[model samples]
Target: MKRIYLSLSLLLLVIIGSRAANFKFAFLTDIHITAGDSIPYNDLARSVNQINDTPGIEFAIVSGDITNIGDRQSMEVVKSLLDRLNVEYHIIPGNHETKWSESGVTDFARVFGSERFKFEHDGILFMGVNSGPIIRMADGHVAPQDIDWIKTELDKAGKEKPVIFITHYPLQPGDVDNWYDVTDAIRPYNIRLVMGGHYHKYMQLEYDGIPGILCRSNLRAKEKTGGYSLCEVTPDSIFIYEHKIGNVPTRKGAYSMTGMNYPKSNAGYPRPDYSVNKEFPQVSEQWLVRSGYEIFSSPAYWDKKVYVGDDSGAISCYSATDGRKQWSFKSDMRIIGTPAADKNVVVFGSADMNIYGLNASDGRLLWKINTEAPVLGAVTIRNGIAYIGGSDHKFRAIDIKSGTVVWSYDGVEGYIETKPLVYDNLVIFGAWDKNLYALDKKTGKEVWKWHEGKPGRFYSAAAVWPVAANGKVFIADPERVLTAIDASTGKTVWRTKESMVRETVGLSEDKRRIYSKTMNDSVVCYSTTTDFPEKIWASNVGFGYEHAPSMPVEKEGVVFGSTKNGLMFGLDAHTGKVLWKHKVGNSLISTLVPLSKNKCLFTATGGEIGLLVIDYKINKHK
Candidate 1:
């Protein structure tokens, strides 16, 4: 009998070993699967396959941004790839998934299979909740059913096992208004781990004793090093490790190389002769030295060389630092727009209501297609076609090489104030008419628009942010309202009224704190999902801020938006209190500029345009 009992005990040990070890699953984020993203879909597929092949990782999860355009086809492509990969996986929708539609709840069911999904593996329960997005994304809430289900799921676990949550947005502790995140719902659960992605960078933290992981985008992973993450979990702890091809991060903008020396300003105003393309300033006298514009779009840089577009409709390649002119393709119209730079092609739009495809190297204009209205936003490139929107009341998909219109949408007309936020082939943006639109990047079909039209959904001045999760888009309108839209169809999910948001700046959210810059000359704080948002404080900002109060810069509860006074105000990213004010004694029409990983509060006012870096002092720890 004793021998029999020993054998039974040995069998029990084997069974426990085979059970879940509380190890981490692989996490991949910001895949950016649009047509011309830095990384391709096939590459990600191979990486996924390889990750599944890795030993000990039982499952995987993607935080969001599975596709760039948020189109049905993009999801189909991604699903097809996932179908072939040998792994059990779950996901959360990011902002890119639904930028145009206000309602993003159905997207998880239609495009990604579901917005909130869960399963039990190895005695641990995993749940996913989407907060949705404010721009081209639909704000997501834990559906009444999902909320009930989470309670049920937790009850099923019964304190015997710790739960894990998967999501696209981050949630940090003691930060700015983070109420829009999963803080409320997840607070009650015995959560051991939480995972999220959306940011291109990698970060980590602990929230209320629960460890959280911020995954990087696959495309961003490739840009930095390799791609993908494999997390190993034990009953006691979770270990997440980054796997990438290269980890070198690409920097934004060109460094100053103009020789006039340290902390220099243009001695005299650059008298720009647009007719002659000449600037009369100190030093270099040549046929217009290479000029860079700080429009809405981020300039792409590769191999120490840089290319950027300006509001004047010029694609200029500069010598990165020296500001030496390499070549420029000057279009016939103003190009105060953004461009998508690939290895060889630069795709963008112009105010002439045209989409232009140019050679990336020499700035050679290869093709241009006119839509006839002011193309206020940047064009999106996927596959071999370029998708663009214009005030001409049209969205066009043009052959990148031929400049021929592949498809076009003429159904809606509004001022396309923001660049098209693409997820898959679905593109989303807001117009001046307070309408958010979603169009086919391939066929230019009107998938949907925000027709719910009410004071609640009216987005007067919302800036479009990339997808937060799979099918979410964030936009703030002039009406001081923030709305989340579904990328596939324009629908209302959740709308926040911030009558103070006259003009919108950037999209910023982390695990604990969330920050947005507006023309209000102030930054507001919503402490948690259940807490009300409060304007932490205000400042004297903006000189030309006829639109709103003053745009502030933000990261980690600190802001540095500009005022019409040509001044940059630094406020606590958390408390919204003034930290420092950099004054060049001139109006800074320029918005906000980031300088480094821990900094970016640097701002340029119009008169001085001098860079001011901010150092924040958050008081929570103190």
Candidate 2:
């Protein structure tokens, strides 16, 4: 079911090329076309056409899973359709396209590889890996033999040139796997960028000093709109573009656990230092008369309404102009994550370990299916099912309509603090066990896992920076440091060093650069680089913070967030100079939530949550 959208941003992508012609091509992945599905096919066609709308383009790359069924007929259909793109297309096969035969990938390799073959375009070497073994299913071996070939090719190539690796599988888990030997082989190279697909959603990570970008596909992207990632590569840095298709409205719901005391296991029992005292508000004038909980999760504003989630485990739809509730739906558990909504049904996950598909018109629950674990993170749905990561230490896909479990990976044992993102055909998420996992969306099999020397543990979900432009994954560890990982192989592209952080929310960004804020009482910005760890600027916004400041927000030219001491701050996004500061009575733990260009929301420990209005007309424009 689809809903009409009030399209906001134009379909055109905004990309900035390198001044030296060092910029290379852009890519997309997981455009699932089942031959006959006109919706997805039209979306893909329109997306490619839009991509062509932007230029300086060297070539086009697709990570994998071009076809839904991997049938000879379907492959032909996708190829013929993609052929109309009016640009050079590089291809990779995902697990879905390789599910048919042992030599299924060989067929894809024969058909798509004629054009998809690895090569150095614009002085950067690009390699392609099929999502599954090109041979067969059970006999499907992730090609270890290819590792030496990449090394040999690079050895023959110049080390000074920035090498970009592309494939369907990521060298990282929550990516593509069986290619660790291949990934380990290329680690010593000066490869600056790694790109992959199969996980249809967008992701960027920095692990072990390697930077990787996983793009969101043309087919099914679980965002406000179905979109594609645009990337630009210079000899030094990569820039990314998050091109949106249209604006779809969302619904509000509660994302919380039904039971108390949280999950057991010594894995994440709060330490004495991590504990804090929380106080409920008094009945005095300090308390608002409203008995209903204010929606806390990020709100998807659509159709003149605000759809957000709260702690009560319910979905609430409210008029954007006022706080009046339009509708509310109660689920079995808490809704701690954001709900992805369109006009028809709002989709979200709950601590009940279930994803609820609710009707947008009313708060009626159409379907509710259980995942492998308790979900604290949101749900990203592509095609028909929703991909979710949870405390169950599993990344799962559930049928959107019938609420049935379609597929899942239980390979790691840890709580899923991050949402499972599906780009083209890949599923990406991080765990408390110190691993980022990528898997095949079609069959629930392991693709690859990105591990960063067990960075202890993490709760902040991983964010996939836009692919192409400046692609990289930003990861945050419990010790409060953030780093970018090469998305292709789970290797570190660069590290922020422990000396630079106190806590983290991972990486947030625009197409131009990355915005990272640490708990060390400061916010810092960095761009993907070859010279390494380039700090654009750092600001000390350490005034009146109760705890380490929550994750920073990058909006316009200002980075905003509040502190535990009930103080709010806005800093120059570039200069790191303090732009604005105000105080409310609450101590904030959550990151700054933006309502519009001028408004933001924050919650504090003194039992205070306020929606603050600001004058950013000038600052937001920068």
Candidate 3:
């Protein structure tokens, strides 16, 4: 009886699949429409007409880069042109939209509904997600929310239904930040095809057991050239056909779906080993505590309580005196940023797209406010309000007392991954859109904005916090230049020599000296008292590929920094001479926390070793 039931279920699936009609759609990408005279309106119009007249074409999917700059006018032009198409369509976001637009992904979303959208046609599941590290602008990263959403949608579709995923960026190991993350999220589901743009040419690839097809752009530089691809989806297999739009319709090529090229046991690629087998250097410390996962966040100290978050989605409080675990709070996802503590309350954001508040002493959950996307930065608390920017492209000020939004500013073109610098009555922060913004703190209105162009772009995605001192705001961008802007007037005061500055800079108490870590594996000191900041001294400190920002912390005329390869350095603050060096263990990415004028704590990540507290007594050195 059981054998008969199983056979019947298989027969029923085959019957349903056989009765399902074959569906076809047009896949267009990289329109790259710009403003004014340089628009691709005619090219897109031709494609629209062709797709409309073509028989059996059910719908269209534009795999990102609809506009060249993601400006409102450009996006509006693309929208109007696409609206002429008789079939329904969907769109995602591309790097061009997130990079060139002043309002980043927000402008694209306003014009096209969202960077992520999904639909069902003829019992087939089709999904589109924006794989944009809009905050960095240099690489691609599918936002955590989008990843989760894809998983949820796949769950709804079940194992037997085929899914087609679309994005603007290629999901290869080096091409995107979290390529394996997306692959891992949907590996359990029956994903049939993955479509991508950004290569500007048609190519088929086998990535992590999925068939990935990249499409060509709709425009050419000097010629009136444009093209679109037709995809035919069946229950068993998929076929792709390319069409070139010219005086007459021309066939480019056709391809049948291919099987996975890599091994199924390893997924995409083998994970890199970040651990070293050597023993760590012994240093005098107070106490140590190890968490179950890696720690990337700097510790927040207040009234003898230390707060920090880890990769395992835990926010734990430790006793500053003896490093005892006092209390802990867990989230559903990783805690990528540090925690902010004040007045018996601790607040932080997580990759789960939720902002959590807890009791500082007891670790009891006070409130949690959910955002539209993942929150990747620490909250900036001022006057009982928590200010944060989320992957949703909105910077919001939430009331700490009630965990409700007070005001939100969604003006920037990129994601907000930085701590808002509250200066005077303004909230100052940077975004992936290469712009620094200042807004009214109370009402969330724009005050002024500054753009980092040409020699340097602020592509660090708000990782570097602005140092507000001496009537100026100083910060280093990922492009290796430091700039000072007048806080009152929002004008450029001066810019330092270009170098590789990918982390937060350190400042002296007198506000005359600035310290920075360079991409060349060197730590340098600069004099801010001069008209243009001048490099005072530099010390060669080797680093590795995993080397984090190593944001140097200062105390009692000494500066301390660490490299990803487990080397730590204590340098003379003024002379830039290395005082001492020590090996902690594995990757040392988190910022050093100063315990006093002399003693401090260094936390290493990537493996088992968690926290180390050292006492560098200044009296002995002086």
Candidate 4:
């Protein structure tokens, strides 16, 4: 009887080990399958066969770009090839599939079941969304309906197990126009990691607070071999391995589900109730504009008029006092960046790749200049010249009066998205190329360039606007490192070891303190008065990582910050202690505009084109 009991115990151990075996699957991204493209088809066929022959791949996920064009024939070709695979598969749409395609999402859904899907495999919840707009080409947008659908899915499965999201584009703040909205929507869910494509390069990233993994294209290109990845997921940890065609697999990396500092949903990882006794600030007035579309552009205040743009391609001017609509003008595409205003004209860039000089008073277009790609950065006007950058990887100095290019600099390799800071005869801006460049304002010549280390590149480019003050240029990057560099020599003064700061750093008017929002859901105040910067204090800002912290403005020793989660905080500037917190709207993107010592204009995205008048006189945070 004792011997029989020992044998039963040993059998139970073996059963438990087999049950807890790691779940593995293949990830193929950016296949770019096209009709008549024999090379890609052949390559995909080989990959499918190899994946089938591999010992332990449960399934595969083709993370977008399955077809080069969104056509019936193209999708059918891809479907036939994928059907030959032994393992089941899933896919999402990429820019190449939707951009410039007539059928767009319809063809993809007909062939692939749905553009967005949610499924459970090996006890892990996988969610994917079509990162493409059916109408537009080459832009990342998850439809409003998808947002609601994801919320429902999260409600059902977010608390059950670790969740993984797949997108054709990385969900970083500035990669897509409205990444913050999507991030905020998912912040309340248990998202362990996000997988994306489109960059066509492997990257390990932390956006806000969630881990992001970008996969390379599976199509063999010039000087580059095709590849895919296999991820092994256990109940507690995940390990990834990269495999190139005709080569052995290499261990990519590994991470734990619960041991990470990642900001997770409260449903999955509950925290102590910080919302207790949290009193929000009062709103004097809330005005909803008739154009009830999404607004991503920061409101530009000039001549007592608030100039802003909505996703519906309308730029409107309103009275700053009562929020009365003054004049509205329509563009061919969406306006993204904040508008720059001189005395008479307001200059801004649009997604349609055009820059416009508009009459700030009457909302009339003075002139518009066409660029090679979408112009995302705000127009910086100095001495009659408008300095702006575009997705075309060129920075052009345009004549603001005539709307013509005076000079163009094509040295940068990535898209330019930051507002150009004009300082000491140089145009300073950060680009997606992972370099901070200072160019001569007049001649468009490179004055100096600086990267983080040894000219190495980060995954996504730099999109943070550089704050130049106190002889230093303060900026942040996608790598989650914030640096303060000497403005004169372009040498690093001090770099912080923190991760997940994408917005421009906030500086105290006296330049003694710097405030930044981190990926761990906290607003930290750093002391810059010393020789080396050090963290003074960090105040928790609820859950999820906010991309942009409203350039913390200080008045009467109280610092104010608006987070992307739509929560505004009034913290003691010296202690980083939360004096009060307020939920303003769906999501806050830009810094707050302090109208007076006790009042500020807070703008947000998601609902309409209007500002919330936040009066601090009566509701001062004690």
Candidate 5:
């Protein structure tokens, strides 16, 4: 009687599992809706209508890149269109929405109800979370908090339930900085497949033996009409098809999910190569610390201490000689801007909509000034005043001691992110409104404002920290053009794309040369005294196809710069000759602080803070 009862129970389980796996869903991505762009808007609308009209589709998943510029207006348009779908939908933000976000990435949650989603349907658990570089240009990263959430959700699903993971970028080294952190977490679970939508094409991929799928964009690129994909799941296999607007569905691929192995080992997968550190035996890390959180800003130095902030809203102070934590203070939100220190006080801004001043010694809160919106701009200190900008369209000068607003400039048209260049009685900074403004530092009055000819904020002079010398201000914008403006008149001295420089510019200590990194593998120098861009020298450093906004710093005749892929290098300040290149990690390196010609302190987006030092023997021989 017991054997007969057990056989009947096994049969019942098989019937329920087969019924649960049989379902169909729609997969749409990269709609890229702009405010006045009728093509993409119309394409997304047609796709929504088609999904509503389809009979067997149960639900839909829109994986990221919902807006073109990540503004409030464009996100609203996307929301209205997605709301018209007949089936329930889940969505996440892509790089386009997070990198250029006008609200410091807060508006996405307000419009979409959340930045992540998870739901169970027909006994299968589906989960999605955001992978972002935040308001800075770097590689995609899964936030520490979000990683914890992913582990919790996957654990609750247990090792016997089928799970599908969703994200914007592929789980690879170049696409996501901490891809291993995610793949390792899900590898232990009964993962069925991974889905993403960054490359805007349909492709089959494998990440350490796990099946992955990349979806196409909804925008009609070179085609008459745009479309999305249809996914069908069965008891033992899953099939994907491309459904063009007004056309029949074409089968893309099919893969079996049953009898697969879980918890794959990381034996053969390619990881970030740190062998470059072995090649450059002269350079080594003096001290290193891992915060386990994404760090977007650079490190600021005070009296014998290094101060840095991370995405967790914590500001920490460490000893300069040895990387030991001295103290830390926490805020209510993330800190995406670099802090400025002067007169024993450290000041920084947070997405919590507050600017804080803390004691340099103990990390005690001196004071905080609230703003109407998130403060994403770096701080600049000049003669006891802290100059910073916020998304509220205001630039302020605050007293370091009293925590009171000394003056406010309310004419900024867009949010500011670069540090103000306090040079020659003027505070110079760039905004997302395609303009750079110079204000009188003493009176808080506008000195001059210069606008780029480009139409969109993507090409605006907003990311690079402006450098000034020889009666001119030098800036590099995203349009691959370097401009030299007259310091006093706000007129263009010369604008040139001859070198093809992006948003990374630095000035020499002697104030005779300006250094910049090109879009390809070269570092070029320009004479500050020349009327036009005069190339001093160009060195091929072998950092291929780099586009990070981290500025170079020169100290004691050694020029130090970092790349988007965790490479920190030094060059001869005069000849542009590569001195040494070290691979610190596999993420974007923030701006470096050169303590001396032999040692430098650096931070990266992947939560690594370390001190790079030349070996004592090598320095002695030199």
Candidate 6:
């Protein structure tokens, strides 16, 4: 009887061990396939063939950056190649897929079926989500909805089953703006490992006791052929091996998958410091609210109400005085552009391929104009006409009252995303085609088109909203140059790389100076009257490596600007003295709307909406 009992116990132990481990899979990331790139396409095809040729590989996990430019054709090409894999594969998008997206970051979802994924295999739950800066150039963010989804999935999986979290970026403060939020959500779960691949190399890291593995990219770089990682799971550990095409797999490292004790609190982790807010006793938040969705545009203020659109295609109205929800209207797709308001009407464009005009008071749709493609451009209202551009390579002037197209220009070679500047009878805007265009506001005729002599669309004057004063149009682009163009003839009056500014510019209310945020740690002002690029003042606000396109707004002697890291600061316009700085959120702050010198309305890409007010009495005493 004793011998029989011992034998049964041994058999049970073997069964448990078999159930806990023994699986193999392929891991690929940062494929970066452009539609016509033969190398990337060939490398991806080889990797697929290799995975198929290898035996005992159950499935695959593609971390992100499946395409180089996030274009629809590139995505479809990637899909066709990936579909050839014999095993199933799960994928997500990286910053590359969202930042320069022509479809407003919607083509990935349309091609891949979802931006996130979740599946269970062999008693272990696997989950993947999108870590994005979205349509703007900022730090990556795990959207609030995605965090909630992770929590729900983990809760359902319970604490007993091991889990693996997959994303594009390594969960760090610099890589992900809200990394702490993600760590906090997964802390209570049985998270075994986190896998990502943005650095294009194999890396072993730890985020508050959670083990992380970053895979090498599939690009060959200087090597003869591209490569990927093969992962094998055992009862006690997971081993990673780098497998290059036409070569043997080299073992990289082994990570323990058992007995991880994640920290309950991020006590010693570095976080965004709000100490600057304490330095300014006068400045305080009046009221703050979270929209629960990503917001890419600034708020539109009209008649004591604030209108803002979000990534979820919901345009919501809030009481401008005290952060109360008034009403909301829903569209079919994401609204990435800011809404423009005039009189009782608010107009905005949606990625659903429609421009909408709504009654400002009740959030009711008054009129909708259909377009051939997504309308990602911000609406500019001037004299009851709405000037906007679309991805269909057309710009239109619409009558806000009657919802009819006053004029349409079909000559733009690329999509438009900036708010058009109506200056001196011309509607001025930039497109991704590497040109700044000036069109007649009434007739939609091209006055003149200006190019920066740069080849790439990234160097185009596309993101900056052209500002004109002193008969010259001032603009900045990704080439890190500030340019002053002849407003009438589109001639380059003066262009300077002296300050290293990129895509953020604004004009002073007095029109004496133009304010631009530098790529590093300063905000430089240029004299609008000078034929040469003359620097008025360069204030080093110490924001550190800043490149957000949040245009500075000057009002009543104060110039207000925000950063990619959610810092809002006020500077003296004439002297460039730092007045007061406040850290608002952990993401990019949009262009601020100054209600007065003491009050301002602001929103952030992290779903933050609030009013900032300065108590003059408190400031006076200090």
Global lDDT scores for all candidate models: 0.53, 0.56, 0.72, 0.70, 0.89, 0.91
lDDT of 1 by residue, 93-183 (tens): 6766634321212334566676667888777777886544322211222223344566777777775466768767665421211222244
Using alpha carbons, what is the TM-score of model 3? Answer: 0.64
Question: Mind giving the per-residue lDDT tens digits that candidate 6 earns over 1-622?
Answer: 9999999999999888778868999999999999998999999999999999998899999988988878899999999999999999999998889888878988888999899999998788899999997878888998888999999989988988888899999998788888888988998888888999999999998886678989999999999999999999887888899999989999987877788646756677777788888888789999999999989999999899999999899999999999999999999999988899898999999999999999999988899999999889988998899999989999999999889999999999988889999998999999988989999988999999999667978788888888999999999999999999999899999999999999999999999899999999899999999899999899999999887789999989999999888899999899898888889878999999999989999999889999999766676643
Clashes in each model (backbone N, CA, C under 3 Å)? 127, 90, 4, 2, 0, 0
Candidate that beats the other on TM-score, 1 or 2, i.e. the better one:
2
Best by TM-score: 6
Best by lDDT: 6
Which parts of model 6 are misplaced by more than 4 Å? 1-11, 620-622
Tens digits of per-residue lDDT for model 2, 201-259: 56665333356667666764445346676666653456766666653212111111111
Better of 1 and 6 by lDDT: 6
Q: What lDDT score goes with residue 515 in model 6?
A: 96
Question: lDDT tens digits, residues 1-622, model 3?
Answer: 9999999999999888765668899999999887674548878888898898888999999988887756678889889989998988999888887544444245576688877888988777889987764522234656555677888888988966667889888887545645776888877766777898898887887566666889878776466667788888765567777767754444443433334423445443644332321222223445666564556567778788888887568888888878788888999766766678878889898877788989898998889988876677667888888888876678888877677889989886666666678988888888766788888999999988886645323354356767676777778876667888888888988876665666467777677888878776678777766657677888775553322555787888778777654566678888877665656543444667766545676665542223444444432443
Which of the two candidates, 1 or 4, achieves a greater lDDT against the reference?
4
Over 221-268, each residue of candidate 5 has an lDDT whose tens digit, in order, gives 999999999999888887899999999999988877677644468778
Q: How high a TM-score does candidate 2 get?
A: 0.47
Model 3, residue 311: C-alpha shift (Å):
15
* TM match of model 5 to true structure: 0.95
In model 5, which residue pairs have backbone atoms overlapping below 3 Å? none
Candidate 3 local lDDT, residue 459: 54
- The CA lDDT at 109 in model 2 is 51
When sorted by lDDT, best at the front, the candidate numbers are: 6, 5, 3, 4, 2, 1
